[model samples]
Target: MSQDQSDKGTSLSLEQILAQAEQDQSVETDYQSGFVAVIGRPNVGKSTIMNEMLGQKLSITSHKPQTTRHRIHGIHTTAEHQIVYVDTPGMHLGGKKSINDYMNRTANSAFADVDVILFVVEAGRWTKEDNAVAKKLQNTEQPILLIVNKVDKFANKEELFPFIEEIAKEVEFTALVPISAYKKINLPAVEQEILKFLPKQNAIFPEDYVTDRSTRFLAAEIIREKLMRTLGDEVPYGATVEIEQFMFDEDEGRWIIHALILVERPGQKQIVIGKGGQVIKKIGTQARKDLNNLLDARVHLELWVKVKENWSDDARALASLGYNDNYSS
Candidate 1:
């Protein structure tokens, strides 16, 4: 075995290591790989689940709904399989802005080409939005794995039965797995279920690859996540981040990033900047810490807020801001 496989084998129990060897010998190193789309309403923990499964954070997350604006591919590779998880924006209703349309369109399109769909829903809570997602998936041929997330919220396990029954009536899922993305509960079962449906094939991406998005895109997302967590209720919906300059300064041995935070109204810009620039300064500090982890090097980040005046609602402006449907690695 290769050194990489040997390293992975060291973590397994003796029985598990033997099982792995037996399986490898039986299949003669057969590999399974495919795409899995994570779909749900806002704040249902779709991104969190994907991040946990990949053993790292690839998608930006916040308590705010619609935080994930773009489709991201979080690729997880092991010796046996490669699962490219497609993380999508939450599907919601009653938003007419161009950005809203873009988010919903990005989510809808993700279901088309995926090998499996992880339909995530909060345990004991089903809304019109969840119903809408279920309705949309009524005729899809791909295997739908109903992930009843956040079950840890319930103190008693029996309480979940009723909610599970309710969900069973709504979605015709191939399998139902209860989990808590936050608590890391039953996550391994989720992976096992997904493997059952994946087709046997060669790896789709290099084993060292973790995501399909550019590092610059992830930096912008990290900045936006800080903005979403820092700003108030209304401002985050109208706010977006654009990376103006991203480069490695060899002399300084640090990555330098200049980001512009755009808002639809001037008041929102003021809210982001705060009374004495304290809020934006805090945002910059938080984002810089995450950027240091993401780049594995010192980062010099500069942030500025500007009034873009309905950039979220203008198609050309949205496209310019990287909201286009053709966005790719």
Candidate 2:
């Protein structure tokens, strides 16, 4: 017997060892999959990058900060690999309340058990706040990919290189990619670099699955996103969307969704409803369009704005708004 067979004793052969190794490798190759977390300060276009990467809007985008409060997973699959992207809340320095603390914790938690960390930075200007964030990311052991977003707005790319180089000096990154998520430039290059770090593994999600959030969850988020965009800063930090009812009729080919827009004060409620209820109507119309597209069915969306003072501080109100105190693991 050969030396390999001798090591395996009389029960095994060299061919079997080689075959098992090949099988393992095959499994690994098929399983080219891993989780990647996108982190940055608010309004850095993290959501834009994720949507562009997946070619869908799994996470809502807005100009306002703290749009994303939870960790949302967007899955992308190909014949060779599966990439699960985790979209997190924008990290900020400090806030007085527990909710702000929760948001910060949720963003930081995405770094754990992730294969790649994409640190998104605004390209137009680099602030001291951005530098502090870069330092925190540099402390992580996982591969970091520095993505400078909004590059299209830059008048001179040469002026931006110094900021990029400064960040590079702060941390060891696998790659530094400068691209505009809004303009969709150099996105393919970013995807390719992310793929290189994922391990081979079977698909963790169904092929058709795009997001881990439920339809109700998405509906609430879409409503809130429209409110954010339309109402702008008039909406307070404590405002949230609560789904009162979500029902579908297969025979009728229609979905009936009833959601309430919870605000911190009565004045804010009036702001959401607008003059002659026109503002709420617009928000409903826009949300319904998104819901129909997401659900692929006719949607009847009913929205109501109500005053729920201090919802952010009220534990019961927070839970009703899907901000479970136990969300932190």
Best by lDDT: 1
Per-residue lDDT of candidate 1, residues 151-175 (tens digit): 9989998988888888778778999
**lDDT by residue for model 2 over 1-329, one digit each (tens)?**
11122111113332453355345555534458778999988879999899999998879888888888878878887888778899988888766666677777788888888899999999867766576677788679899998989898878889887877777787778898999999999999898999888877666555655666666777788888998888867584668888898777667768889999888888888888899999999999999999887777788899998887887777666665777533211
Q: Which lDDT value does model 1 have at 256?
A: 85
Model 1 scores a TM of: 0.90
Cα deviation of 268, candidate 1, in Å: 1.0
Candidate 2 segments whose C-alpha is farther than 4 A from its true place: 1-30, 325-329
Tell me how candidate 2 scores on lDDT.
0.79
Which residue pairs come into collision in candidate 1? none
State, as a TM-score between 0 and 1, how close model 2 is to the true structure.
0.88
Best by TM-score: 1
In angstroms, give how far residue 124 of model 1 lies from its true place.
0.3
Q: Estimate each model's TM-score.
A: 0.90, 0.88
